[model samples]
Target: KLRIRTPITTRMTGCPNGCARPYVAEIGLVGNGPNMYQLWLGASANQTRLAWVFQERMNLDDFERTLEPIFIEYKKSKRRAESFGDFCDRAGKEELERVVNEFDPSQSLVKTTAKPRVSVTTETMDRLTRISDIRGLSPSKLANEILEQYIDSLETTVHAQK
Candidate 1:
């Protein structure tokens, strides 16, 4: 097991509807079809940045095996206090792809089975559902868009102040 210095925010959604804010998560997994997912990585821990799609379609059975190279590289090369997402961002897509392509799973030492759990209150869900119905968008998608707009507005205000 790798001892990570910071918490990683991983979000998984059953569909592209993004009820879990997967786009902004450090590790986002969006189900594209039966037993297939779009793997995403590189968002900031604070949810300030959007994650990028690392793999367009990854088999569910290959999840742990596919990430072994990445985890190994992270454990060996990350800077002090750097999170998994930060490391991914620093490495970029090209480097990550190279590593994955050249990795020998037989020599791998990492195996992860950790899963994240999230809870939504009924009241909040009901509100989101109502608003989302009126807006013709998924609740999570609407919420994320609003959050992005709010963050952008804040940045604009800060720039104005300066």
Candidate 2:
């Protein structure tokens, strides 16, 4: 006899990008604002596919009501150990579209807008120079190595706390 672990799904809110990367989890909820959310479903292990935007700017009340049924249906129909992404794919595009549309008709027309590019400033240049001085390396060399390492460490520390 073999025991199987059920697929786990997780939700997070208030992330800057609303956790659009579906591959990151079986179910991911990203906050669009105070009472709005974006949904993502899937995992990267299969193919690194992203969840299609199911609904954009959904009110919290509507999200709770609409998502419950969809998840319930998924649980009922899903093959043993099937991930949400794989389930969606197996269920086909029409079914996924129906679910998204049933929750919010606007979902069909909603498009994710690209964020504006940021320009580096003189202040950033000075900071880079300071880092180079501290590391006893040229700006180009420090930029390639120590700067990324320093930033990555900071991010790691912050993420660890969360």
Model 1 regions more than 4 Å off: 110-162
User: Candidate 1 — worst ten consecutive residues by lDDT sum?
Assistant: 110-119
Candidate 2 ranges beyond 4 A from true positions: 1-5, 18-23, 44-47, 97-162
Cα TM-score per model: 0.65, 0.46
State the TM-score for model 2: 0.46
Cα error, candidate 2, residue 140 (Å): 57
Clashing pairs in model 1, backbone N/Cα/C closer than 3 A: none
Per-residue C-alpha lDDT of model 1 across residues 48-130, encoded as one tens digit per residue: 88899999999987888778888888888989989888899999999998988899867866544444434579998898889
Predicted candidate 2, C-alpha RMSD: 15.3
- lDDT for position 115 in model 1: 49
lDDT of 1 at 41: 93
lDDT of 1 at 74: 84
